[model samples]
Target: MIAKFTPVLLFFGIVSCYNVRKHKDAKVPGNANDYLDYVLSLARPIIASSGLDPIFPLPEVTGTFENTILGVHWHGNVALYNGFLFGLSTLTRAGDATLEVVGFRMDFTGDVGLSNVQAGYRCHYDVQGVGDDADINVLIPYVSARFSSSTFLLNTTTTMNSFQILNIGSPQVTFQGFDGLDWVAEAIADIVLDNLGEEILEALESGISDILECIISVTSSDDPNLSIDSCVPVRNVKVIRRN
Candidate 1:
Protein backbone atom coordinates (compact mmCIF):
# COMPACT_ATOMS: atom_id res chain seq x y z
CA MET A 1 0.00 0.00 0.00
CA ILE A 2 2.80 2.47 0.89
CA ALA A 3 4.60 1.83 -2.41
CA LYS A 4 1.39 2.34 -4.44
CA PHE A 5 0.60 5.66 -2.65
CA THR A 6 4.14 6.98 -3.33
CA PRO A 7 3.76 6.49 -7.09
CA VAL A 8 0.37 8.22 -7.13
CA LEU A 9 1.77 11.25 -5.23
CA LEU A 10 4.69 11.50 -7.65
CA PHE A 11 2.34 11.45 -10.65
CA PHE A 12 0.19 14.26 -9.17
CA GLY A 13 3.29 16.40 -8.52
CA ILE A 14 4.37 16.12 -12.17
CA VAL A 15 0.91 17.11 -13.40
CA SER A 16 0.90 20.22 -11.13
CA CYS A 17 4.25 21.39 -12.50
CA TYR A 18 3.06 21.04 -16.10
CA ASN A 19 -0.07 23.09 -15.40
CA VAL A 20 1.93 25.92 -13.80
CA ARG A 21 4.29 26.15 -16.76
CA LYS A 22 1.43 26.31 -19.25
CA HIS A 23 -0.24 29.14 -17.30
CA LYS A 24 2.99 31.10 -17.21
CA ASP A 25 3.39 30.92 -20.97
CA ALA A 26 -0.22 31.83 -21.76
CA LYS A 27 -0.55 35.33 -23.37
CA VAL A 28 -3.40 37.84 -23.74
CA PRO A 29 -5.07 37.23 -27.10
CA GLY A 30 -5.71 40.20 -29.44
CA ASN A 31 -4.58 42.08 -32.58
CA ALA A 32 -3.13 45.58 -33.12
CA ASN A 33 -6.61 47.14 -33.32
CA ASP A 34 -7.60 45.58 -30.00
CA TYR A 35 -4.45 46.84 -28.30
CA LEU A 36 -5.04 50.36 -29.60
CA ASP A 37 -8.62 50.31 -28.31
CA TYR A 38 -7.48 49.23 -24.84
CA VAL A 39 -4.87 51.98 -24.64
CA LEU A 40 -7.24 54.71 -25.84
CA SER A 41 -9.87 53.72 -23.29
CA LEU A 42 -7.38 54.09 -20.43
CA ALA A 43 -5.73 57.28 -21.77
CA ARG A 44 -8.75 59.44 -22.58
CA PRO A 45 -8.88 61.32 -19.27
CA ILE A 46 -5.13 61.83 -19.06
CA ILE A 47 -5.07 63.10 -22.62
CA ALA A 48 -7.86 65.59 -21.96
CA SER A 49 -6.14 66.89 -18.82
CA SER A 50 -2.97 67.53 -20.83
CA GLY A 51 -4.82 70.43 -22.51
CA LEU A 52 -4.56 68.90 -25.97
CA ASP A 53 -7.50 68.03 -28.19
CA PRO A 54 -10.24 67.06 -25.75
CA ILE A 55 -11.58 64.64 -28.32
CA PHE A 56 -8.82 62.88 -30.20
CA PRO A 57 -9.52 63.35 -33.87
CA LEU A 58 -9.31 60.12 -35.88
CA PRO A 59 -7.10 60.89 -38.92
CA GLU A 60 -8.53 61.18 -42.48
CA VAL A 61 -6.43 59.38 -45.15
CA THR A 62 -6.28 59.30 -48.99
CA GLY A 63 -3.93 58.91 -52.02
CA THR A 64 -3.74 59.69 -55.79
CA PHE A 65 -1.55 59.38 -58.95
CA GLU A 66 -0.94 61.45 -62.10
CA ASN A 67 1.10 61.16 -65.33
CA THR A 68 1.97 63.82 -67.93
CA ILE A 69 4.14 64.14 -71.08
CA LEU A 70 5.54 66.85 -73.37
CA GLY A 71 7.55 66.75 -76.66
CA VAL A 72 9.26 69.11 -79.20
CA HIS A 73 11.20 68.64 -82.47
CA TRP A 74 13.64 70.68 -84.66
CA HIS A 75 15.42 69.41 -87.88
CA GLY A 76 19.16 69.92 -88.86
CA ASN A 77 18.11 72.96 -86.96
CA VAL A 78 15.54 70.37 -85.78
CA ALA A 79 15.71 68.55 -82.39
CA LEU A 80 13.18 66.18 -80.68
CA TYR A 81 12.70 65.68 -76.90
CA ASN A 82 9.97 64.23 -74.62
CA GLY A 83 9.34 64.06 -70.81
CA PHE A 84 6.81 62.47 -68.38
CA LEU A 85 5.95 62.96 -64.66
CA PHE A 86 4.09 60.74 -62.15
CA GLY A 87 2.92 61.39 -58.57
CA LEU A 88 1.29 59.52 -55.58
CA SER A 89 0.08 60.48 -52.11
CA THR A 90 -0.85 58.74 -48.79
CA LEU A 91 -2.30 59.90 -45.43
CA THR A 92 -2.27 57.98 -42.11
CA ARG A 93 -2.54 58.17 -38.26
CA ALA A 94 0.25 57.56 -35.68
CA GLY A 95 0.84 57.97 -31.89
CA ASP A 96 1.02 56.37 -28.40
CA ALA A 97 0.23 57.19 -24.68
CA THR A 98 3.26 59.15 -23.38
CA LEU A 99 3.43 60.24 -27.04
CA GLU A 100 0.60 60.61 -29.58
CA VAL A 101 0.97 61.39 -33.32
CA VAL A 102 -1.99 62.17 -35.62
CA GLY A 103 -2.74 63.68 -39.03
CA PHE A 104 0.24 61.77 -40.50
CA ARG A 105 0.37 62.05 -44.32
CA MET A 106 2.78 61.89 -47.33
CA ASP A 107 2.82 62.76 -51.08
CA PHE A 108 5.11 61.45 -53.86
CA THR A 109 5.91 63.27 -57.13
CA GLY A 110 8.25 61.96 -59.83
CA ASP A 111 9.32 63.10 -63.34
CA VAL A 112 10.37 60.68 -66.06
CA GLY A 113 10.97 61.35 -69.72
CA LEU A 114 10.43 57.72 -70.87
CA SER A 115 10.64 55.39 -67.88
CA ASN A 116 8.49 53.86 -65.09
CA VAL A 117 8.63 55.13 -61.43
CA GLN A 118 7.97 53.12 -58.24
CA ALA A 119 7.75 54.16 -54.52
CA GLY A 120 6.38 53.15 -51.07
CA TYR A 121 6.00 54.69 -47.55
CA ARG A 122 5.23 53.25 -44.08
CA CYS A 123 4.61 54.79 -40.61
CA HIS A 124 4.05 53.26 -37.14
CA TYR A 125 4.51 54.01 -33.37
CA ASP A 126 5.43 51.98 -30.25
CA VAL A 127 3.76 52.20 -26.82
CA GLN A 128 5.02 50.81 -23.50
CA GLY A 129 3.90 50.58 -19.86
CA VAL A 130 0.68 49.35 -18.22
CA GLY A 131 -2.64 51.20 -17.65
CA ASP A 132 -2.88 55.03 -17.55
CA ASP A 133 0.69 55.72 -16.46
CA ALA A 134 1.98 54.14 -19.70
CA ASP A 135 4.52 55.94 -21.93
CA ILE A 136 4.37 56.26 -25.72
CA ASN A 137 7.50 56.75 -27.89
CA VAL A 138 8.39 57.70 -31.47
CA LEU A 139 11.44 56.25 -33.24
CA ILE A 140 12.11 58.17 -36.46
CA PRO A 141 9.83 59.05 -39.40
CA TYR A 142 11.37 59.00 -42.92
CA VAL A 143 10.70 59.23 -46.69
CA SER A 144 12.54 58.24 -49.91
CA ALA A 145 11.95 58.72 -53.68
CA ARG A 146 13.64 57.88 -57.01
CA PHE A 147 13.19 59.21 -60.55
CA SER A 148 14.33 57.96 -64.00
CA SER A 149 13.86 59.90 -67.22
CA SER A 150 15.13 59.87 -70.84
CA THR A 151 15.64 62.34 -73.69
CA PHE A 152 15.80 61.85 -77.54
CA LEU A 153 16.47 65.37 -78.87
CA LEU A 154 19.56 64.09 -80.72
CA ASN A 155 20.27 60.65 -79.20
CA THR A 156 18.78 58.34 -76.52
CA THR A 157 19.71 59.44 -72.96
CA THR A 158 18.74 58.20 -69.43
CA THR A 159 19.05 59.82 -66.00
CA MET A 160 18.24 58.53 -62.48
CA ASN A 161 17.92 60.43 -59.18
CA SER A 162 16.99 59.43 -55.60
CA PHE A 163 16.24 61.36 -52.39
CA GLN A 164 15.58 60.51 -48.71
CA ILE A 165 14.54 62.35 -45.52
CA LEU A 166 17.27 61.44 -43.05
CA ASN A 167 18.94 62.37 -39.77
CA ILE A 168 15.81 61.16 -37.95
CA GLY A 169 16.11 61.87 -34.21
CA SER A 170 14.31 59.70 -31.61
CA PRO A 171 11.59 61.05 -29.27
CA GLN A 172 10.65 59.57 -25.87
CA VAL A 173 8.96 60.29 -22.50
CA THR A 174 8.27 58.62 -19.12
CA PHE A 175 4.97 58.71 -17.24
CA GLN A 176 4.27 57.77 -13.62
CA GLY A 177 2.84 54.29 -13.22
CA PHE A 178 -0.92 54.13 -12.67
CA ASP A 179 -0.45 52.38 -9.30
CA GLY A 180 1.64 55.37 -8.09
CA LEU A 181 4.79 53.29 -7.88
CA ASP A 182 8.21 54.90 -8.48
CA TRP A 183 9.02 52.28 -11.17
CA VAL A 184 10.00 53.92 -14.49
CA ALA A 185 10.97 52.65 -17.97
CA GLU A 186 11.45 53.75 -21.65
CA ALA A 187 10.36 52.52 -25.17
CA ILE A 188 11.07 53.18 -28.90
CA ALA A 189 9.36 52.86 -32.34
CA ASP A 190 10.35 53.54 -35.97
CA ILE A 191 8.85 54.98 -39.21
CA VAL A 192 10.14 53.47 -42.47
CA LEU A 193 9.97 54.85 -46.03
CA ASP A 194 11.00 53.43 -49.42
CA ASN A 195 10.88 54.87 -52.95
CA LEU A 196 9.07 58.19 -52.29
CA GLY A 197 9.16 61.73 -53.81
CA GLU A 198 9.83 65.30 -52.49
CA GLU A 199 6.27 66.63 -52.25
CA ILE A 200 5.22 63.53 -50.29
CA LEU A 201 8.30 63.77 -48.08
CA GLU A 202 7.48 67.37 -47.06
CA ALA A 203 3.86 66.48 -46.33
CA LEU A 204 4.93 63.50 -44.19
CA GLU A 205 7.36 65.64 -42.17
CA SER A 206 4.78 68.33 -41.44
CA GLY A 207 2.18 65.75 -40.40
CA ILE A 208 4.61 63.92 -38.10
CA SER A 209 5.66 67.18 -36.44
CA ASP A 210 2.06 68.15 -35.79
CA ILE A 211 1.33 64.76 -34.19
CA LEU A 212 4.44 64.93 -31.98
CA GLU A 213 3.57 68.41 -30.72
CA CYS A 214 0.06 67.32 -29.92
CA ILE A 215 1.33 64.34 -27.94
CA ILE A 216 3.81 66.47 -25.96
CA SER A 217 1.25 69.11 -25.06
CA VAL A 218 -1.31 66.50 -23.95
CA THR A 219 0.93 64.09 -22.06
CA SER A 220 2.91 66.78 -20.25
CA SER A 221 -0.09 68.26 -18.46
CA ASP A 222 -0.31 68.25 -14.62
CA ASP A 223 -2.21 65.44 -12.89
CA PRO A 224 -2.84 65.11 -9.19
CA ASN A 225 -2.32 61.33 -9.30
CA LEU A 226 0.37 60.99 -11.98
CA SER A 227 2.80 63.66 -13.22
CA ILE A 228 5.65 64.03 -15.74
CA ASP A 229 9.23 64.54 -14.53
CA SER A 230 10.93 65.71 -17.76
CA CYS A 231 10.55 66.33 -21.52
CA VAL A 232 12.82 66.45 -24.63
CA PRO A 233 12.39 67.19 -28.37
CA VAL A 234 14.20 65.76 -31.42
CA ARG A 235 17.03 67.75 -33.02
CA ASN A 236 18.98 67.80 -36.33
CA VAL A 237 16.68 66.94 -39.25
CA LYS A 238 18.52 65.08 -42.07
CA VAL A 239 17.69 64.86 -45.79
CA ILE A 240 19.62 62.85 -48.40
CA ARG A 241 19.46 63.16 -52.24
CA ARG A 242 21.17 60.45 -54.34
CA ASN A 243 21.44 59.18 -57.91
Candidate 2:
Protein backbone atom coordinates (compact mmCIF):
# COMPACT_ATOMS: atom_id res chain seq x y z
CA MET A 1 0.00 0.00 0.00
CA ILE A 2 2.76 2.49 0.93
CA ALA A 3 4.74 1.70 -2.22
CA LYS A 4 1.67 2.31 -4.39
CA PHE A 5 1.00 5.67 -2.69
CA THR A 6 4.61 6.78 -3.20
CA PRO A 7 4.01 7.50 -6.94
CA VAL A 8 0.99 9.64 -6.15
CA LEU A 9 2.91 11.73 -3.61
CA LEU A 10 5.79 12.22 -6.03
CA PHE A 11 3.40 13.31 -8.80
CA PHE A 12 1.76 15.82 -6.51
CA GLY A 13 5.13 17.27 -5.49
CA ILE A 14 6.19 17.73 -9.11
CA VAL A 15 2.89 19.41 -10.00
CA SER A 16 3.25 21.82 -7.08
CA CYS A 17 6.74 22.82 -8.17
CA TYR A 18 5.61 23.51 -11.70
CA ASN A 19 2.71 25.62 -10.49
CA VAL A 20 5.03 27.69 -8.33
CA ARG A 21 7.39 28.32 -11.22
CA LYS A 22 4.53 29.34 -13.51
CA HIS A 23 3.19 31.74 -10.93
CA LYS A 24 6.61 33.32 -10.54
CA ASP A 25 6.66 34.17 -14.22
CA ALA A 26 3.03 35.28 -14.33
CA LYS A 27 2.54 38.84 -15.70
CA VAL A 28 -0.23 41.17 -16.79
CA PRO A 29 -1.62 40.39 -20.23
CA GLY A 30 -1.57 42.40 -23.49
CA ASN A 31 1.17 44.55 -25.08
CA ALA A 32 2.60 47.93 -24.04
CA ASN A 33 -0.08 49.91 -25.88
CA ASP A 34 -2.85 47.87 -24.29
CA TYR A 35 -1.29 48.27 -20.86
CA LEU A 36 -0.97 52.03 -21.35
CA ASP A 37 -4.58 52.23 -22.48
CA TYR A 38 -5.70 50.29 -19.43
CA VAL A 39 -3.67 52.52 -17.11
CA LEU A 40 -5.16 55.63 -18.74
CA SER A 41 -8.67 54.22 -18.33
CA LEU A 42 -8.13 53.87 -14.60
CA ALA A 43 -6.61 57.33 -14.42
CA ARG A 44 -9.52 59.04 -16.17
CA PRO A 45 -11.54 59.34 -12.97
CA ILE A 46 -8.62 60.67 -10.99
CA ILE A 47 -7.68 63.07 -13.76
CA ALA A 48 -11.25 64.35 -14.01
CA SER A 49 -11.46 64.70 -10.26
CA SER A 50 -8.26 66.72 -10.24
CA GLY A 51 -9.74 69.12 -12.80
CA LEU A 52 -7.16 68.25 -15.43
CA ASP A 53 -7.46 67.25 -19.05
CA PRO A 54 -8.65 63.66 -19.04
CA ILE A 55 -7.77 63.04 -22.65
CA PHE A 56 -4.51 64.10 -24.20
CA PRO A 57 -3.77 63.91 -27.90
CA LEU A 58 -1.04 61.56 -29.05
CA PRO A 59 1.94 63.28 -30.70
CA GLU A 60 1.57 63.86 -34.42
CA VAL A 61 4.24 63.29 -37.11
CA THR A 62 4.42 65.33 -40.29
CA GLY A 63 6.77 65.78 -43.28
CA THR A 64 5.53 69.06 -44.69
CA PHE A 65 7.66 72.17 -44.07
CA GLU A 66 4.66 74.24 -43.07
CA ASN A 67 3.71 71.65 -40.47
CA THR A 68 7.25 71.44 -39.13
CA ILE A 69 7.62 75.20 -38.70
CA LEU A 70 6.82 76.36 -35.18
CA GLY A 71 7.22 79.76 -33.45
CA VAL A 72 9.95 78.33 -31.20
CA HIS A 73 12.80 77.46 -33.48
CA TRP A 74 15.47 75.47 -31.60
CA HIS A 75 18.05 75.33 -34.43
CA GLY A 76 18.81 75.86 -38.11
CA ASN A 77 18.70 79.17 -40.00
CA VAL A 78 16.00 78.43 -42.55
CA ALA A 79 12.43 78.88 -41.29
CA LEU A 80 11.30 75.72 -43.07
CA TYR A 81 14.13 73.64 -41.54
CA ASN A 82 13.47 74.80 -38.01
CA GLY A 83 11.18 72.15 -36.50
CA PHE A 84 9.89 68.62 -37.08
CA LEU A 85 7.00 66.53 -35.75
CA PHE A 86 6.89 62.76 -35.47
CA GLY A 87 3.99 60.30 -35.23
CA LEU A 88 3.70 57.64 -32.54
CA SER A 89 3.25 53.98 -33.45
CA THR A 90 2.96 50.80 -31.39
CA LEU A 91 5.54 48.01 -31.60
CA THR A 92 4.69 44.61 -30.13
CA ARG A 93 6.84 42.04 -28.32
CA ALA A 94 6.27 38.55 -26.93
CA GLY A 95 7.49 38.91 -23.33
CA ASP A 96 7.60 42.66 -22.65
CA ALA A 97 5.96 45.53 -24.53
CA THR A 98 8.38 47.38 -26.83
CA LEU A 99 7.19 50.45 -28.76
CA GLU A 100 8.88 51.73 -31.91
CA VAL A 101 8.09 55.28 -33.09
CA VAL A 102 9.07 56.52 -36.54
CA GLY A 103 8.82 59.43 -38.96
CA PHE A 104 10.08 62.77 -37.64
CA ARG A 105 10.49 63.95 -41.18
CA MET A 106 10.77 67.52 -42.47
CA ASP A 107 11.00 69.15 -45.90
CA PHE A 108 11.57 72.67 -47.29
CA THR A 109 10.94 73.93 -50.82
CA GLY A 110 11.73 77.64 -50.43
CA ASP A 111 14.80 79.72 -51.39
CA VAL A 112 16.66 78.03 -48.50
CA GLY A 113 16.01 74.35 -49.09
CA LEU A 114 15.82 71.71 -46.31
CA SER A 115 14.93 68.23 -47.56
CA ASN A 116 15.30 64.52 -46.87
CA VAL A 117 15.41 64.89 -43.07
CA GLN A 118 14.21 62.05 -40.87
CA ALA A 119 14.14 61.10 -37.15
CA GLY A 120 12.64 58.42 -34.92
CA TYR A 121 12.01 57.54 -31.25
CA ARG A 122 11.43 54.15 -29.63
CA CYS A 123 10.08 53.38 -26.14
CA HIS A 124 9.79 50.16 -24.17
CA TYR A 125 7.97 49.42 -20.92
CA ASP A 126 8.20 46.34 -18.71
CA VAL A 127 5.00 46.22 -16.69
CA GLN A 128 4.70 44.02 -13.63
CA GLY A 129 1.85 43.34 -11.19
CA VAL A 130 -1.94 43.51 -11.40
CA GLY A 131 -4.46 46.31 -11.06
CA ASP A 132 -3.31 49.72 -9.81
CA ASP A 133 0.11 48.91 -8.38
CA ALA A 134 2.56 48.06 -11.15
CA ASP A 135 6.28 48.37 -11.87
CA ILE A 136 7.33 49.83 -15.19
CA ASN A 137 10.67 50.48 -16.92
CA VAL A 138 10.78 52.83 -19.91
CA LEU A 139 13.50 52.82 -22.57
CA ILE A 140 13.77 55.36 -25.36
CA PRO A 141 16.11 55.05 -28.37
CA TYR A 142 16.36 57.85 -30.95
CA VAL A 143 18.04 58.87 -34.23
CA SER A 144 18.24 61.92 -36.53
CA ALA A 145 19.71 63.39 -39.71
CA ARG A 146 22.58 65.78 -40.68
CA PHE A 147 22.42 68.01 -43.70
CA SER A 148 24.71 70.34 -45.73
CA SER A 149 23.85 72.89 -48.40
CA SER A 150 25.37 75.91 -50.21
CA THR A 151 23.82 78.94 -51.86
CA PHE A 152 23.77 78.91 -55.65
CA LEU A 153 23.21 81.26 -58.65
CA LEU A 154 19.98 81.56 -60.62
CA ASN A 155 18.18 78.25 -61.09
CA THR A 156 20.97 76.40 -59.27
CA THR A 157 20.59 74.11 -56.20
CA THR A 158 23.06 72.29 -53.92
CA THR A 159 22.12 69.53 -51.50
CA MET A 160 23.93 67.14 -49.16
CA ASN A 161 22.33 64.84 -46.60
CA SER A 162 23.39 62.00 -44.33
CA PHE A 163 21.54 59.84 -41.84
CA GLN A 164 23.26 58.97 -38.57
CA ILE A 165 21.61 56.73 -35.97
CA LEU A 166 22.26 58.23 -32.54
CA ASN A 167 22.82 55.62 -29.89
CA ILE A 168 20.94 56.86 -26.83
CA GLY A 169 21.30 54.13 -24.25
CA SER A 170 18.26 52.67 -22.53
CA PRO A 171 16.78 54.79 -19.75
CA GLN A 172 15.52 52.55 -16.94
CA VAL A 173 12.53 53.43 -14.72
CA THR A 174 11.46 51.39 -11.72
CA PHE A 175 8.08 51.99 -10.06
CA GLN A 176 7.47 50.55 -6.61
CA GLY A 177 4.04 50.17 -4.95
CA PHE A 178 2.12 51.94 -7.72
CA ASP A 179 -1.37 51.01 -6.53
CA GLY A 180 -4.02 53.57 -7.48
CA LEU A 181 -5.51 53.53 -3.99
CA ASP A 182 -2.18 54.62 -2.58
CA TRP A 183 0.02 57.59 -3.44
CA VAL A 184 1.02 57.93 -7.11
CA ALA A 185 4.54 57.51 -8.53
CA GLU A 186 6.22 57.68 -11.94
CA ALA A 187 9.52 57.59 -13.88
CA ILE A 188 10.19 59.80 -16.89
CA ALA A 189 12.46 59.08 -19.83
CA ASP A 190 15.58 61.30 -19.79
CA ILE A 191 17.18 61.14 -23.22
CA VAL A 192 20.60 62.64 -24.00
CA LEU A 193 20.57 63.98 -27.53
CA ASP A 194 23.81 65.97 -27.09
CA ASN A 195 25.18 64.49 -30.29
CA LEU A 196 21.99 65.26 -32.18
CA GLY A 197 20.80 68.79 -32.97
CA GLU A 198 18.95 70.99 -30.49
CA GLU A 199 15.57 70.53 -32.18
CA ILE A 200 15.64 66.79 -31.57
CA LEU A 201 16.86 67.30 -28.03
CA GLU A 202 14.03 69.69 -27.24
CA ALA A 203 11.49 67.31 -28.74
CA LEU A 204 12.73 64.48 -26.52
CA GLU A 205 12.62 66.65 -23.40
CA SER A 206 9.05 67.73 -24.19
CA GLY A 207 7.98 64.16 -24.73
CA ILE A 208 9.53 63.03 -21.45
CA SER A 209 7.74 65.77 -19.54
CA ASP A 210 4.39 64.78 -21.00
CA ILE A 211 4.95 61.15 -20.11
CA LEU A 212 6.01 62.00 -16.56
CA GLU A 213 3.01 64.24 -15.95
CA CYS A 214 0.56 61.66 -17.22
CA ILE A 215 2.09 58.88 -15.15
CA ILE A 216 2.09 60.97 -11.99
CA SER A 217 -1.50 62.13 -12.44
CA VAL A 218 -2.72 58.63 -13.14
CA THR A 219 -0.99 56.98 -10.19
CA SER A 220 -1.85 59.64 -7.55
CA SER A 221 -5.14 60.13 -5.70
CA ASP A 222 -6.48 62.73 -3.34
CA ASP A 223 -6.19 61.94 0.35
CA PRO A 224 -6.70 65.25 2.06
CA ASN A 225 -6.55 63.75 5.52
CA LEU A 226 -2.84 63.01 5.26
CA SER A 227 -3.47 60.65 8.13
CA ILE A 228 -3.82 57.47 6.14
CA ASP A 229 -0.46 55.72 6.35
CA SER A 230 -0.90 54.00 3.01
CA CYS A 231 -1.94 57.22 1.31
CA VAL A 232 1.59 58.59 1.42
CA PRO A 233 3.18 59.50 -1.90
CA VAL A 234 5.90 57.35 -3.41
CA ARG A 235 9.40 58.46 -2.47
CA ASN A 236 12.67 58.74 -4.38
CA VAL A 237 12.03 59.28 -8.07
CA LYS A 238 15.20 59.21 -10.16
CA VAL A 239 15.40 60.52 -13.75
CA ILE A 240 18.47 59.91 -15.92
CA ARG A 241 19.27 60.72 -19.55
CA ARG A 242 21.61 58.17 -21.07
CA ASN A 243 23.96 58.83 -23.97
Pick the TM-score winner.
2
Candidate 1 has which clashing residue pairs, if any? 74-78, 74-79, 75-78, 95-101, 98-136, 107-200, 144-196, 145-196, 166-238
**Candidate 1 segments whose C-alpha is farther than 4 A from its true place:** 1-164, 167-196, 223-243
Error of 2 at 148 (Å): 36
lDDT of 2 by residue, 7-45 (tens): 222322443335334443222222333433433333333
Superposed by TM-score, candidate 2 places the C-alpha of residue 165 at a distance from the truth, in angstroms, of 10
Query: Which residue ranges in model 2 land beyond 4 Å of their true spot?
Result: 1-33, 37-81, 88-95, 98-198, 219-243
TM-score of each: 0.18, 0.21
Residue 55 accuracy (lDDT) in model 1: 12
Kindly list the per-residue Cα lDDT of model 1 for residues 1-243, writing each as its tens digit.
Answer: 001122212322343334334443211122222332332333333333332211121121122222222442211111101111122111111222111111111111221111122222221211222222122221223223222121111111212123234322232322222232222121111111111233335433443223323322223222333222121222232232211
